[model samples]
Target: MSFQHTDSIALSELEGRAPTHSDLESRGITSSKEKDFKEDVKETVADSPVDSDVLIRDGVQRKLGQRHIQMYIAGTIGTGLFLGSGGALHTAGPLGALLAYVIVGTVTYSMICSLGEMTSFAPISGTFPHYAARWVDPALGFAVGWNFWYQSVTSIPTEITAATILLTFWDENINNQKIYTAVICVAVISINIFGVRIFCSTAEFIFSIIKILLIIALLIAGLIIDLGGGPSGERIGFRYWRNPGPFNRAGLVESNIATDQFLAFVQIFVQAAFSFGGMEAIAIAASETESPRRNVAKAIGRVFWRILIFYVFGILMIGMLVAYDDPALLTDTGNAAQSPFVIAMDRAGVKVFPHIINAAVFTSAFSAGNTTLYSSSRILYGLALRGQAPRFLTYCTKKGLPLFAVLISSSFAFLSFMRVSKGSEGVFEWLVNIVTIGSLISWLTINVTFLFFRRGMIAQGIDMRKNVYHNRYQPWLALWGVLWLSMFILVNGYAVFFQWNTTDFLVAYINIPIFAALYFGYKIIMRTKIWKPHEMDLITGIPSIEETELPREPPHTIGGKIAAVLF
Candidate 1:
């Protein structure tokens, strides 16, 4: 096998002395491949006699346990599922919307599984960006890291905006949305700055409990209403499905009814992307979780089942109880008014239900914004550590919080102030539109990176049996995931093609060109190669990571056993 070498002085050398080219040459230090420099730096740092505190402080401690991991998985049940699904139900019929979510869930599970396989072996803060560099190219890593960071950072303001909107459901007289937005942003930032255990894990655990309980309550209520147990004793079991019909006739040209329904189904498929956006956050928490290799692997295996029960089943129940043509679902009011679950209860004459559901929805949005800040900040810190971002971003507090990165990520939350401008709502919407596609892009990259990573392992003569975690199906699942995600990305904006609107087109497809610019631009600027399998760094950080002892098993008490199984 041919080899490529770089004169790059890894970060370890930066700590030793001024990183001069001549100084590096004097030591005869050379990296075998440009793509593998990160591994070389990690190995050098791990073996160096320099203070371990330097490296330790830059990275977070693994204070999160199984309960925390479970909370992180459920933390993002926000506007995407609560309010966004209303659009799906409106555009597509009940069955079409349900099918859309089910399909996305399948693809999301594949993406999560791929991420889990890579992270279990090397639980680092850099996550997929590091994997992209290791398995693909350094330039690709730079692009993916920044793209994901922006996606995560921008989402905080989106959630904050959604939360403020939800709050107004109680009293429309409240005119100052900025006050609520600013306060929520500040609160989320403070929680993150306090350290992961105190905030990310604890807040998520509490919020997830709130979300899960509310969802369970909502589902039980829906079932009872469907069974003729409401105040009017009216059974609504699939009645709406038969009346407004199971399929929606949605198209610009007014074509065949069946064809239009199919088109609506496709549109819903794309819309479902946002609902499952942050579901892979479990993999992102790899570095912060206690016994990450074991706990993350466990979470990865179990989170999908939980998602199916909470999200998919909830959607199914909504379909059974709520008609697609319900007048309340057509509102642009922007609150619990748009939630099908709330609308169904209101239609069934379930007084006082909307208030309870609205409160739960508000909590979901807040928790989602909190997780977004945490994820985005860590991505920035990881990028800085890998030399893809500014050096100052890697600065962490004594408590292991990436304070600088947190500040930068939260800065975007102020964008919510655009709501005050009379005519700037369109501008704000445009900015918001640019970010929604990022999650799909991230999913595509994860699958591609996983493919290369698997090949690298085989090429380097590593034994698959020794892996800490591996997906059930060998490359096929990842291949299908990549193909499906790519298809979804390309055709996500199909509605624009039927009748083009410049803004709608831009909103649907703009992220593609932006991602292309970043990827090819970085590749051209750096002159990096698509990494060769033999050149991959399969074993660099593993030795040091394996040297540390794994956490002891959980206690054998009944509560511990239940936690062990559920988490």
Candidate 2:
């Protein structure tokens, strides 16, 4: 993501034309040879009355602040970690789950580092999918952009459905689920309708804080439970691992300890990958962030801590408290009823904690859906800005909300309504099947794009140190990500192989062919050529971004310093 510097003043010569309010009207830059680029500029500048300009001036306000970006690193910790960890533990045992999460965490951090560099350098709203197009090939960008948008749209309903189930944990006799679904959908959309400041920054910041507090409380409770602080006063220290023996042999047909355990670990690895899926959503707010060079990198740097504390430690606590063979882990009560935390609490004979944890799970589901829909809208807005989607999606309200994109993505929330009644299960399953593998594909694209992007920077003689943000072992880190993930994705549904279930195999591998279709389809139809190293255009957007963003003000006062450190 870093560019080359010719001398000590890396950006001295980089300074170029600045954007002003008077430039709001069409740039009027017409180039028949590069019609797509010309049209992209027009659509961007025209976000409000006309296209995309200085982020503050129009088309998505530079509304996200330091706290928003800082808090948002953990913004999407949803049912996956809270509830799904139980399933992961059940499948892979304690040590296996921990190892799985550590592996994914490593890959996730590598990808994030590369992303931070690119985002710091460009700070474009279009984010990394577009980076694939610019740095790797346009066809790859087209595939990734559409795949990510579709993935986000589908995830909103999935969270809403989880929220409803968590609500039923409170009121089991509740019927006519549509009313509840509609209510949750409205609440999520209502937050975003007001604009980025209200929904993304303020709301998500609050959501993340609550989530962090809840997790810390749970971890403390877990420790107490492990130390026999519960009503039974039974010290349960690592006894479950010793008894069940640290491996479940969950789905294996025959009992080969080594082979079964290895297969089990693979299963949890896939789940762990999904758990860390949305960290890259950090880039979605690039344009709207006040100072991308400063804030975006800060947020990326903190991702490691979030993953360690929230996920790795959280799983450790679950494994410590809940045994792999705990029957509650297999329950179909369809709420936090099956959450390993609640399972642990129930085993400890703690009566009240389940209610508190369930409430948090409900909040988690709602928060995740809220943020997912917001991200989906922004990704669509990016797609439209890049001419990959319908032009109308680029339209923005006066508050810098991508009005049309929001509306379209919001419509997808209705998919949650399928849960209102029976008989739609088939269709719902089909929809979920479509985007099941989207996360791995997105991660793979980021690494691949980074490889090309790095090559381009070197070819142009750009100074690596001059990059707005620099992390060591980059191109190499990204290269490892690319190879490891390609193999990981291929074996994503390894269980399907031993069992030979068509639906499961398809669900696991569906995005592969879909991505290939989008890539080859676009290549054949548009006749676009892959970009050569020297031809990559990192310079086009950075100059305007640097000129438009407010000057960086380093934190000085104690409060500011504390905020900076925490965020």
Candidate 3:
């Protein structure tokens, strides 16, 4: 595997004195792969690193460009934000839910900052897990990689369910939701199987642009409704917050109102985490992106705006437009009708726009599902490259699509059809719980992994901000993420204890033991050691001196400048 991105140290573009054998020994950079890679960098994450004498093309294609990276990150703005946020609002009230999202958004942004720093330097498909193996513990990598893959598999169905649920807005009487699920599933799988080039450049980019436009439109429309721009001309200005009183006590109310409301707020963290779940796919996309060193950093740096416009503003608007206690929010129809945006429109005597919003949401669900499938397949391929998954999973088509990996990942999405027997809304809740647990786990692991990455870089005398992307708050920002994420992960399943529901408990916390088993089991069986900071493999993926090219120029045209700043 030959990595294509040029690093400041590894690339010949920046002239500097090369480190001598004695200089390297003094720094304790003892990895044999690190030393050997200086002469011949085997870099692509598409397959195992091979000998330079007889190298092959990386299995995955680098087709995604800056535009694709921008929209792909925006793709997570789907069912969770548009539809599921109503549930979060219902559970946590207006202010409570608003605060929950804001808190989760902060931690998520920190993780993205840390992720951007490394990906700009060593952009790879497996992403955080691969970083873990090189910078922290190999056992942690094995466990986290599989955990992340499971998270990806489960995410596909959650989005599928969201799409099927949205279809009920058109025909609530259709009982065979399984048909809708299967149809949606086929559409998503087909787009992915079409190959990464068409998948990202065409279908994926279109999906992202549509979602972004719709989100902006919704934000504007929501603000208007809040200010009495509707047919009814009713200014609902925080009236719901006054009457409902900004806190919804959970069903686990064996305690006082404050405790129950606290539990309710705690539960919303899970929902919000689910809403912000797919940020890591940005780093995952780095391996397949054209010029990841430049484009991936640009995409990640723009995350603050994405979260502000897509989540924080949207949450505030939802809270102000609709009352948390509205019966419509908890509806069993599990479609667009329960959506706060739809509810706000309906209450404001707005007729046609609900359908329009519902259609946008329908598109959002499909786009999110497509992203989940693509990320999952690539993750499996990454695992195969590391010898964690089966070798057959690494096989790719001539166009560089991971064929077997796509098929296997698509198979897991069939779980969406389980709603045929379980019912749509119930199944949606169950799957959301499961997926949220997986997402929180993945985020916490990424933060911890970044901490280790930072220590290794510092110990090896690598400069964080010298020609490399980095946050000044650094290890502190990552620490903040670790602290909060761990708290949420622990408290997520606490409500189940009050209610004593076996299913909820299992769905909410089962990943913990499974993750522990995988981590410790791999450690004991493989006899892997926790890598020290100086011993980490930081240079393997960096470009060798021979691989550097002329530096990229600044954007000259208006269009190019717009893309440079926004995408």
Candidate 4:
């Protein structure tokens, strides 16, 4: 799977320089030349193993395992189920929220498969964006990489803000959210700066404890309350749904409920997507795994059940255990003091549970933010390796950490405090909206890239049957993902643009225009044109599956074995 640094047909040979749109038009390079230029760029770019090599260091150290992947996925599942559910319930009503989650979850499940298949085959530090450039089009690669980077950067602050807000429930006198956010951001940065294994191990431990404890506590409390043994007295199963008529008091078409509900559902889809955002982070780390192909395949295969159990079941529990119509649950304060989980626990007669849940929620938010920092830094490092960013970002410390990238990524969280200082939440809201849009765009690009990658594989006579992981109905799945995501962008984005009362439409929807500008601007400046199948990097020829295999490890010493058993 190693790429030869030198090739017979260099990028310069295809285009006197990197072909710009003007150059393509003036040189009269027909569709054929355009395709050739794209292919050449892709092949040349793909030929280097610079980023992957640095990430794995010749595949010597293998730290991530099944547990790490499992917890990593759980970490991404988030406290959204615990806290964010109330908002969804209010917007869509009980049934609407349930259906909305199901719909979005289905799409997410499919997307995870598509991503899993790609990473299982061509595990790399850059992950999907690199594949987009190599297999689809260079413009697409550029768009996705930057879009994801932007999403990751902006998302850090929101997570931190959530952590700070949650902390306030314990002590109202803690006024310095910015200071706390800064401190947490620094701590996460330090963890990531230590290396991927340390970062992942910390994430695994934190997320596993938080997720398991929360779910267990909720299950136990729900059972106790349902069995008529709680402080609140007898069972309340499905009583809330019945009284609420399984829908919000405000109908979908009603001014406050209809428009708001529909829009809120759309926004929640984005939020759900973002909450599941770092699932792909598992694949990004797969390149460094001992057995990337097998492990990634196993991880992706379990995505459906994981989402069902952790997300679907968890939300269903929330809906059943707590009244959707509770005013406390419906509050849109977006402050931590008003967490639905905390309120739900209080109402369910669980003494001291709110504090415990708040602490876990804070840890979960911190974990989410910390993981985003790691993901963003790696993405930046990948971009640098491809010459898309400053080369300095590609440099790794002795511990294999992207120090500069971590610093840059972590700094974005500081901007979260702008909402408090500016007296207008416009900037913060705009950033959140942009993160949504950017993430959607990245997802769309990944699907599109997968479609092209599948085609290139087939054309090159690569047998899909041989792959342990395969994305069924490739072109169809990819096309559907693209279409649905486009609808999300347009339908959701149009509101931002046309809604006259909205203050940050320009900032919120800016990612679309910015992406278009980058694509066309790069095309015009570099004369880059669309590519065809033959001109695609078509790394389907490389046997990455064979190249990546699990390394053997020595048996644990007695002390290690005892620790393993106890732990």
Candidate 5:
């Protein structure tokens, strides 16, 4: 039967023909339900009337397409793979680092699957925060939304900081560095203010072209170097792997997997995770697309292959070309003069290519910062919609963009300048730490929300297996993501607290207490309780102004058939 949003589905329509609790119980759908207990909750939401006369201003025009989606994914993948892989390689050894990326990518793929199912069913601008409010709890939506906002704010400076450092590759003058960073930030903010389509389309074109070209060049150069085409006619051919021995020199020790290797692995994992972080942006964009269900499903399905090919293979090639033990690889001594990619090109005797690569690195950092701004602002808009934050943030411009939310979110970029004044990298490092924790929280929440969502579906006699976008191996995939995130939080969270010679422990550990305070604090203030399926908001099921006018029959035209197929 086709699904349609109508005023109501009569109880008589369900009547004796409805799937009873015993039927679900016999199918072993027990959780919070039991045999002879009250009947299972229905899938229908309460028919509460909204003030239809009141209009919530529609934000920014929705103009993005499949190309925009593809480019956003490419840009996110490029950021970490191109610049961050060097650090990961140094930590885990070539083999260990490769393994870590593959493992993380696999976990990410699973989480995306869960997210895809939900997004397809209910594509909206609010995305996951809205889902959390509807299917989980309002407090969860608040916490997740604000946490992501903070992350985006902090990342602005982090990316600018990266841009400043990268600038030193060609010019060591600090004055020039400051000017360039300011210009790039202003440009990014302008693009965002203009509209998401403009920002997304520009980013998609530049990033897609650059990333594809870079990958092709790296693959060709790596092959040539491996085949004895270097200055000394030496074939690199996996010698670094053997000499350093699969694991790093410091990591191979018998005691606790060696401090150097373990630290290296942890560091690389953090970077890899950061690089892969923006994949979730696709879910956010899914809301604005013309055919969200099909586009979102296609995007999520491509993630596994994208991570493996773009991240895994890209790092493998980089490691083979440059030995992990090279002292230059460790030059992150707070100096931008020492990018591993630039260093590798120099070592390979390609004098001019290093400059070319440096330029690309600068653009990549700016693009990351730009996208972060867009994401964080959209989340703020989501929060405002749920009455978690101030209502003014819900204001949208004629273009349909949430102008106030974007401005408020962009203000966080000013905080990045504080890093310049302090002359201490501590602020920047603290920001990164907080971003990591926030990401972990988001990951955990998504999985937990999915668990409840799936259970609710079964309880209401909705067979998810029959849905177009299905999540098999239910609680297992969600459970794995949660477990991994928990382990990361425990290990990394405490590491921030107990660092041997650092005063930033409190700053780093502050996110946990802050997150806790927000969650419980909002729960009390809002008087929100956990939700059951039947009580969920059902925002997606609510008919839009346009949809409300259409007849409730399956279309028969060729165009209609195509639209149905696509959606």
Candidate 6:
């Protein structure tokens, strides 16, 4: 009932300046005989007003701040760092796993930096998905939007399955896994239905603090164990790294030593990619973020350092304490017993710590699952507003809840039931592989979209110096991200080449074909063209965005200053 229509404004703004044939040719948009294509695009956009303003869902205001964004990211860290690292540890050895995480982390940093720059200019919901439509093609936008929504929807069940598994860490003899799963599903859905302020400001903030405290405690305990301060007074000191050797055998082979190690490294590389999947949640929160441009800029700048502390340092400690061949790492119970962090503590004779760590793991899993519902529903609502999805999804309640979208997204939580029959570990890995592939494509789309965005800005003569947030080495960073991600996408199914298992191949490579079908199918139906560089709407929402003000300056007290730096 409260939707803001962009049609009239977009129609007048774009129709006033249809690009001439010469202009199109100069920008490499068309062949000499393809003049009709340019006119088609001009006419199409002129009639459709792309919504440039943030739709006020049920009177919700932008209230999320820097602290909220940081904690949201922290909660998104999930249980992967604690439990899922076992597979990587076994496959790649300590050094190999560490290198894999470092590589993926670097790529993710570059990707989010590019996104921050773009979102600062237009802090819209469906952020990069909207940019894809404007700067590239409508069909690309459609494909990416739905792909991301699907990824988020699937991730909910994955985290629920993980939560159930974490409970098992305390009582392996328990018989109520499904009951636990249902409780988590209902809790997260309820949190999302209450709208952004409660979810981001309270529930997520508290859960993230628990997560941060747990990681810090683990880090200190790990250091103590490595330094001979544990109950056994044993100084582990990278003993595992040296003994199992630096690299595990690749292709699960023993004789083909070099090849086996290389394959194993690749396996670890992909697992690292999966572990870092949800770190981009801050970008999704841009529409609801108070002083979005400034806050998002601050958050993005700090993301890399956070990754270093939580992931790189955490991985380093795990490597020091647990050997790749440890029987604990090989357990498929889908519980915290397999957590390298728990394993490390148990090995040091700290028997009680594992229970504490397992409780924290449950908190991390539930928080991550809660975040997925928010992101998925918001994405669907954004799509509905843009006419890419069923219009009912855009309907919001007085509390700013996208009720229909939330319900639809919550329905996917039932997917966790698959674990009941398929086995929790197997089903969890299935979900992880699919999510990893989808996220990689999403990252690739962000980079390519940013490159086009840069071209349009330069073509329109917008000065970057005066902008509040701008990345300096863009197009290059984007270019490298695209190239690197492309290589990984091609080789994501490398395991199949060695043994040729049908399930493994499908799980690894199915997303590519699915994405292709969505992209081309939409292209054919809409008759859209690859948007030329000079023709993109690069400055549509700047005036309204500029009028927004921060409620107050960031904290200036001594403790606040320290928080500003550390967070």
Per-model C-alpha lDDT, please? 0.78, 0.78, 0.77, 0.66, 0.67, 0.78
lDDT of 3 at 191: 92
- lDDT, candidate 3, at 106: 92
What would the per-residue lDDT of candidate 5 be over residues 27-96, giving only the tens digit for each residue? Answer: 4556464432223224232232111111233354447765576667776643466667777777677887
Candidate 6's C-alpha lDDT?
0.78
RMSD of each: 6.0, 5.8, 5.5, 8.5, 7.9, 7.1
Candidate 1 accuracy as lDDT: 0.78
- Model 3 residue 106 CA deviation (Å) reads 0.5
What C-alpha lDDT, on a 0 to 100 scale, does residue 413 get in candidate 4? 75
Per-residue lDDT of candidate 2, residues 1-567 (tens digit): 222222111121223223322332233333332344433333333321112232222277677887887776678888888889998999989988988888888888888988888888778767887788778887888899998889989999999988988888878766846778889998888887878888866678877888889899999989998999989999999987897868778567575778888888887777888788788888888778887778888888788888898898998899889988888888867687888988888888988988988888888888888888888898888778777889888888878899889989998888988766689977897787668678778888898888888888888887666777788878888987787688788888888777798887788888888889999999899887777776665544444443536776888899999887888
Candidate 1 lDDT, 167-216, residue by residue in tens: 89986765667678778878888888888888756688899899888888
| Candidate 1 residue pairs in backbone clash | none
Error of 3 at 91 (Å): 1.2
Q: Lowest lDDT 10-mer window, candidate 3? A: 46-55
lDDT of model 1, residue 169: 90
TM for every model, in the order presented, reads 0.90, 0.89, 0.88, 0.82, 0.83, 0.88
TM-score of 1: 0.90
In model 5, the clashing pairs are 59-400, 59-401, 60-399, 60-400, 60-401, 61-399, 91-264
| Worst 10 contiguous positions by lDDT, candidate 5 | 45-54
Model 1: residues >4 Å from true position, as ranges?
1-57, 543-549
CA lDDT for candidate 3? 0.77
Q: Give candidate 3's TM-score.
A: 0.88
